[model samples]
Target: MVDSGVSAAYPIIKNYIESLGRSLNDLENILLTHSHPDHIGCAAKLKEKSGCQIWAHSPERRMIEETDLQFSVRPVPGFHTLVGGSVSIDQELFNNQEIYLEENLMMRVMHTPGHSAGSVSFRLSKDDALFTGDAILLPGEMPIYEQVDEYLLSLRKIDEVGAKILLSAWDEPKSGAEIPSILRASKNYIEQIDSAINTTCQNGKSDNPIDFCKQVLERLKLPVPLANPLLVKTFQAHLD
Candidate 1:
């Protein structure tokens, strides 16, 4: 599976596989796009049940093996503490590395770090698809890149790939003429975020990132609980 979802999702995955007359053990590899709890949550459980090898970018290996590393940066809410558990990485992927799935099927890894330091996107040569996990967000969603410049570069990289199908962890797939718009929207969103930060600064508000993000959120009419922290992080990236 591309992502394991949350821990409670294992049973659902197993059931879906069984419906296809396949066992969970038939699964051989779990390729992680990043080490986010929602994406790598059930990896350990799935590995225990199906003996599948987990693969992720080298920078993400330590986080997968020691999940506490993630929580240390982004503290987990009490309700989500059980969402993810640590798992050993059987293979550490690198940029431009090709993973041969079968005689004719192959996937190329692309190191598209932005949302997180270790974030990556996968390119399926045969299918002409790119699986981007949080490296790009849909329009209107909070753009939370740790490094704005890197994020812009990654978006350019995606545009250069010209994948027929664009798959993201949070948004529906885009294809054909719809694909370029995603890249454009991502870049435009970053510009919009920067503008918001600039406007906040012009208003002579507290220069504190948290306070600046609150004004930006209010200006954008976004909810505080959902958009505050992410905007603050994005503002910090701008500062950096």
Candidate 2:
């Protein structure tokens, strides 16, 4: 499994895996995209049932290996409810690293940070498919990244890959010409959020990040549910 969904998705994922004619015990690896609770929620359970060796970047290792520390510091909303638990990473991944699943089948790790310090995307060398996990969110989605600059740079890196198949965690799989279009659109959405931030605080952004996030969301006419501490942190990235 590339990235496990929420804790509630465990049985669903397992059933799907079984439906494919493979038992959970047959699995051997769980490659993480980042350390976000939602992204790594069912990881622990998956690893436990399958004896899979989990792989994650060094920047995210601490969080992925220590759920208590993550909750104590970040304290994301519904953190405890969402995350199944933490599990140790068997191998540390890095930029340009190639992982062979089997003979003639390979996955190239792309260190596409920004969504998080350790965020990564994987490219299936044999099939030319890219599995981008929350690295390229669409316009209607809530913006949640650590650094706007890094996110933009990562987007450019993803574009350079020129993969024929673009499989994002958020959006439907896109292909061929649609890949670049979606990437460019994702970049533009970030730019739009940047502009909204500026417009919301035309008098200069407030020192209070939470308030600033609310103002920007109001300016964008985004849903109230989107206003949260993570979104606040995302807005604060521009200030930094």
Candidate 3:
């Protein structure tokens, strides 16, 4: 599987695999797009049960193994309990690295760090599909990043791929003509957020980040919880 959903999702994944006439043990590799808890939650357990080798970008290896790196938000209540435990990466992936799944199946790794320092996207050479984790979040969903430049660049990189299928972690897959628009929309959303932040600061609405984020959220018609700690961090990243 490209990215395991979460710890609670293991049974579903295993059952799906079995439905395909393959057992969990039949799986050999788990390619991670990032080290986020939701993305990597079931990796260790899957690896333990299936003896699958977990692969992730080198920068994300430490975070995946140690589970110490804080990407966007500080751990809130039940954070550890909800995110589950960490897993060790068996192999470290690099940009442009080609991973062979079979004689005819190969995937190219792209370092698309923006959402997190070690975030990555994968392009399936044979399928003409790009699996973008949180690198390109859907509209109505908050996009958090530690670096704005990196995130923007990553979006461009994804666009350059021109893949027929664009698969995102949080959003439904986009194919054909719809794919390009999704990429453009992701970039445009970030730019709009940046502009709003600048305008808010210039108008001297609220200097406090929390209040500033609220103002931006209201202006954009996004929910408070969505903007609070998540988009708030994105705002902070831009300010920094």
- Give the candidate number with the greatest TM-score: 2
Residue 202: error of model 2 in Å? 2.2
How close is every model to the real structure, measured as TM-score?
A: 0.93, 0.96, 0.93
Model 1 TM-score, all chains together: 0.93
lDDT of each: 0.83, 0.89, 0.83
In order of lDDT, best first, we have 2, 1, 3
Per-residue CA lDDT of candidate 1, range 30-121, in tens? 99998878888889999998999999998878878888776776664541555558999998889999989998888999989888888889
Between candidates 1 and 2, the lDDT winner: 2
Clashing pairs in 1: none
True-structure RMSD, every candidate? 1.7, 1.3, 1.9
| Per-residue error (Å), model 3, residue 18 | 0.6
For 5-55, candidate 3 gives per-residue lDDT tens digits of: 778888999999999999998999999998777888788889999999999
